[model samples]
Target chain A: MDRLSEVSASLVGGFEYNCIIFFCTLVMAVPLGLVITFGSMSRFKPLKWVSKTFVWIIRGTPLMLQLFVVLYAPGLIFDIPIKSRMTAVLIAFVINYAAYFSEIYRGGIESIPKGQYEAGQVLGLTKPQVFFKVVLFQVIKRVIPAMGNEIITLVKDTSLARIIGVTEIIMCAERFTKQGLIWPLFSTGLFFLAFCGILTLLFGYIEKKLDYYKG
Target chain B: MSILEVNNIHKSFGKTKVLQGVDFTMERGEVLVILGSSGSGKTTLLRCLNFLETADKGKIFVDGRLIFDADNKQKPSRAEIRERQLNFGLVFQSFNLFPQYSALENVTLAPKLLAKERADFKRNKAAIYDEIEKNAIALLDDVGLKDKMNNYPCELSGGQQQRVSIARAMAQDPKILFFDEPTSALDPELTGEVLKIIRSLAAEHKTMVIVTHEIEFARNVADKIVFMSEGVIVEQGAPEEVIDHPKQERTRAFLNKLSK
Candidate 1:
């Protein structure tokens, strides 16, 4: 029982790191992703091309490799290192997840029928009003499922931050495995499973709430 | 002076010319019904008049004020275009109500948004909102949709959805209302309720431009009829002069086909 308490105490500290990374990445990525979506869908050719190319490169590459690059590249390429490990993890994770989220947003926005825009315009709604008042809620309703999938993945992906020496729950469990104690590592799975389960319930609730939006 | 004057309107998509030098004039309180087979530019003409599509070449005057001048070297600003668009309202073939909002919300959304631009909005917020809500409920009731005002678009039938869209259009009280094949998307049994509301609007002497395939309805409701073929107006006159005694061969062929 004493050993179990010790293991639980250390895991809790590591889990705090995971939660911080998870929330910070989400808080920064959600709005950043919307900005990127608008950039990709812009009518200006150069801006659209840049945003598309950036998303393609980030999505094509692996997240683990991005972590290494973000932590090391400024020092290697520019001779000025990213000082904080947490900042590096956050920078890489936010950009990577934002690229994925932007594509989901693009799909949601594009799926709206042209008739909606014409309807809004004929009602004398300016372009921005049409987007905010007419289109935004429908897009939110459509993208929720896809966004939920990414969010669940983000919970697990937070473990990858350990590669940059920013210790998370899984890495803390790994230290116990190295000492020939395996039960704590197995216990780590409970944390992830419970987190994902709660998220599943959350996403299901959101989808039901938006059920009236059939578009 | 004519309430609306569209002169020499021309539009094309890539190489396909949809509207070529179409011209017409509408008096206040006149109902102008446009008839044409599919791909004959009737819908495109309506779209151009509503500013959904900018004409390649033309001039449009509303209330004797120039609204669209394609020949002008500089394009109109977004605000300018929006200001001009306020003069007309369009009901689409498909009832494009915002699915997320209830019927009452859909009818009131545009007016409330426009109301925000008023100088007295902040000081008179409660009164302004109450007035907008009252107007929306009245408009919905006028279209026989009083009971369905709180229902979402998906909860309503196709006819109910169309009625809500008509109420949405009427909320703005436009100078000229345009319908682009409004009932074409509805079930036949459901068409009567919608047509009845339109006939009542006609009886009220509301100026309207309608593009529809309902020959009998057009004959009964139109003050003037314009038959278009191949991107141009072939004939336009009073209903009896144009529908029963068409001068152009194209108009005659169209009426004969409809009769058969």
Candidate 2:
């Protein structure tokens, strides 16, 4: 009982770090992904090429390598250091996951029937109004399941922040293991399992709310 | 004077010409039914009239305003062309109702969008809602689907969906309505119901341009019948004159196939 309580106290700091990365990624990834989707769909050849190339590079490379580069490269190359370890982890995550999310978003938006856009134009809706009023809900409905899967994976991925020396839950638990207490490291599973379980329930609720869009 | 005119319109899609120097004109409140085989460019002609598909070369005038003139290459601004578009409404064969909105909401969307840009937008909302509700109910009542206003497109039958589409087009109160094979997707029983509604619209003197394969419906309802073949207007006159005593060998052959 004493050991469990000691490990739990130490893990609280790590849990906070995990929560920050989770929230930050959600905030940054969704909009950035939308921007990337626009870029890939752009009519300008250079802009489209640049956006697609960036997404390809991010998706092609390892996330761990991205984490190291993001953490170290700014200071090494430009002398403008990214001083915060948590910020560096966030930058790596946003870039990596934004690429993935952009593909999903592009797939969802492109899957809609072209006839729908023509119908909107026939009603005299301008481009922006048509997107927001007609296309946005359908895109959200189509993309939700894919996005939910990524969000659940993001919970597990928060532990990768420890590689950048941010004392997230696993890193906190690892500290106690060095003091010859191995059980604390295993007990960290409780925190992860609980977090994942809650996330599953929340996503299930969201899916239910969007049940009107059966397709 | 003609209310709408299409003069020498030409359109093509990447090496395949769809319309070749087509010309037609409609006076106010004229129901013109265009008959054609598949790929005869009937729908393409309608699309060009609305500027949905820009004609490769043509002149289109709506209410004496030069909307499209390929010779000068000077056209009305986009906003001006859109304003002219308000004069006509199109009903597609596919029943392209905005699937997300309820039928009533679909009926109200365009007016609300237009009203939003006006100065007295908010003050007009209630009156617009009343007008939309009344017109929607009347249109639905005409089509015998008044009870399905709140229903989504998926909940309705094909005929009901098409009726709702007609109601949505009528919601704008356009001067002319365009129908592109409106009954092609409906079963026979449903087709009868839609035909009855369209016939009634004709009776009410609502100007309509219909592209259809239903020869009997065309013979019964059309003020004028235009037979098209291979991207050309082959024969045109009153239905009895064109369908019964066609001048062209092609029109007679086409009618013989339809009877068989």
Best by lDDT: 1
Give every candidate's TM-score on chain A: 0.98, 0.95
> Where does candidate 1 stray beyond 4 Å?
none
The prediction achieving the highest TM-score against the true structure is 1
Q: Relative to the unseen true structure, what is the C-alpha lDDT of residue B214 in candidate 1, on a scale of 0 to 100?
A: 95
Candidate 2 chain A vs. true chain A: TM-score?
Answer: 0.95
Local distance difference test, each candidate: 0.94, 0.86
Q: Predicted candidate 2: interface RMSD?
A: 1.8
lDDT of 2 by residue, B1-260 (tens): 88888889999999999999888888887889999888999999988876689889989887887767877666667687667677778888888887878887787777678777777768887886677678777777777787888888878888888988888888778878999999998887889878888999999989899999999999999989998888889989999999889999989988899899
lDDT of 1 by residue, B118-142 (tens): 9999999999999999999999999
Candidate 2 has which clashing residue pairs, if any?
A14-A169
TM-score (C-alpha) between model 1 and the true structure: 0.99
